[model samples]
Target: MISQTLTLELKQVLGALLFGSRRPISVADMRRVLLEVAEQNGDVGGRFAQTSA
Candidate 1:
């Protein structure tokens, strides 16, 4: 499991990456991207939840 601190960092990073994105990003897009990254390191949900907040 990833620490909350690290999760927050990734959330910030991913948010920044997505902020410059063009067009609308749907829920599936967010889920897929977060799951792909999270399942790899076991922290996707943490980052994803942060984004939702």
Candidate 2:
């Protein structure tokens, strides 16, 4: 599980990205941005997982 601080930071980052955008962002784009942020912060471990759902 990720820490609360990291979660909050991610939320803030996501919010900034979303709020600053003029056009709608796609899921793939958002996921890529989030992964970039996580990787930058050295939080790219098991934080991202692919499910067949």
Best by TM-score: 2
C-alpha RMSD values across all candidates: 6.4, 6.3
What is the clash count for each candidate, in the order shown? Answer: 1, 0
Against the reference, the lDDT scores of all candidates come to 0.59, 0.60
Question: Tens-digit lDDT track for model 1 on 1-53?
Answer: 87565443565646855896787777667766665665565654545543442
Clashes of 1: 1
The regions of model 1 sitting more than 4 angstroms off are: 1-10, 42-53
Clashing pairs in 1: 38-44
What's the C-alpha lDDT at position 11 in model 2?
Answer: 54
- Return the lDDT, model 1, position 31: 65
